[model samples]
Target: MRVGLYPGTFDPVTLGHIDIIERGLALVDRLVIGVAINRDKGPLFDLEERVAMIERECAAITARCGGEIVVHPFENLLIDCAREVGANVIVRGLRAVADFEYEFQMVGMNRALDASIETVFLMADARRQAIASKLVKEIARLGGDVSKFVPPMVKNELLKKFA
Candidate 1:
């Protein structure tokens, strides 16, 4: 079976993320969404919260895609996480040229760390390309409506969090 790892901070799952998740599953038998704990960048949501949010979002997509979407929390090196999960590919989303430049470097580093693993980048859907977790959180925290960018569950959580 072809297993792919889609790792992200996922502070709060957004529509763009869902778009990537749905598309990523098409390239692999099973796509494991790894909610990585980035200690360097302080996140609004905790690890458990992020995992739960992703699980909620992925549950709906799982049935539609006819594939398994497992949410796992990891703190170790991404390559190690990929190896542990038996993933031969790392799925990533590119929203713009800036995202590509950053992801491109990371892909090179990942390849250097594990030559056997490959990185696949999927372009974000045109409408969702402008949505990002940082901007979503910022807008939500500042008492702005973010219903259009995130799922209802995440929107509610953001409201309650900022409320």
Candidate 2:
């Protein structure tokens, strides 16, 4: 089966992420959402919390898309995580040219590590392109509405964190 891995910090799952997951499932039989454990970033949500949020948000998407969605949490290198999940394609979402600049370097390193695995970039839907987790969190923390950026469940969880 064609398996793809979509890796992200997902501190708090956002609508932008949901868009990518829904679209990425079209190309693969299984899509693993690799939740990265980046201690350096000191994410607002813990690993368990992040995983829970992703699972909750992806539930309906998985059902509607007719593909298996796995939420895998990893603290290792992204390429290693991809191999562990048996993913041949690493799917990434591009919001703007800035995103591509960073992703370009990552693709180069990943290719050098394993030439067999490939990376695919999916441009974000224009409506959701400006929605980022960092910005979403900041807005929520400052008592602003994040309903547009995240699902109600996720927004509630985020509000609790800021509360």
Candidate 3:
């Protein structure tokens, strides 16, 4: 069974993230969405909130994709999280040249940590490539409608947060 780990802060799950999860599911028997507690990123939502939001959003996608989707929240190193979940492959979504360059370096370091684990990169869909969590937060903060960028639940949460 090929298990893939897709790790991200997912402060609030966005459409672009769902796109990657759907695409990543195609290559592995099971795709685990590892929601990491990235202190460096200063997430707007708490760990539990992020986990609940992702679980709520991904339920349908997991059913329709014909594969298992596990939304697990973790702490510490990503490589350690992958190992804990028994993931042999790591799924990364590359939005542009800069993303590729950054991911390339991370993959090298991951490989050095564990040669047995492999990294897979999927290009973001053109429509959603520009969507990012930080931008979504900024737009919401400034009273812009982010209903299209994020799930309805997240949009509501963002509104309440700003309200």
Candidate 4:
């Protein structure tokens, strides 16, 4: 089976993320959404909360797309997580030139770490090219509606967190 790993902090998985997940699922037999644990960047939602939100969002997408995509949280090196999940490909979303530059470098490092592993970049949908979790959180924190950007479960969690 062609299993691919899509790793992200996913402070709050957004529609843009769902778009990428849906698109990535098309190219692989199985797609594992790996939620990275980062200590430096404090997240708006706790780790478990973020994982639950992503699970709900991806579940909804899977139901619509009819694909077998697994969502899980990992608190380790991305390559390690990929290895643990028996995945040989890493799927990344590229939004722009800047994103390409950074991802390109990381891909190289990942390749060095595991020569057999490969990285694939999927361009973000034009409509969501500029949407990110940080922006979504900021907008929602300020009482701005982000119903269009995130899933309903995430929106409700944000409302409760900020309330």
lDDT per residue (tens digit) for residues 1-163 in model 3: 9999999999889999999999999999999999998888889999998999999878978778778899988887889999999999999998889898889999999999999999999989999989989999999999999998998898999999899
Between candidates 2 and 3, the one scoring higher on TM-score is: 2
- Residue 158, model 3: lDDT of 94
Model 1 residue 63 CA deviation in Å: 2.2
RMSD of each: 0.8, 0.7, 1.0, 1.0
Clashes of 2: 0
Alpha-carbon TM-score of each model against the true structure:
0.98, 0.98, 0.96, 0.96
lDDT leaderboard ranking = 1, 2, 3, 4
lDDT of 1 by residue, 121-160 (tens): 9999999999999999999999999999999999999998
Clashing pairs in 1: none
Clashing pairs in 2: none
Model 1 spans with C-alpha error above 4 angstroms: none
lDDT at position 54, candidate 3: 90
In angstroms, the error of model 3 at 26 is: 1.5
How many angstroms is residue 106 displaced in model 2 relative to the true structure, after the best TM-score fit? 0.2
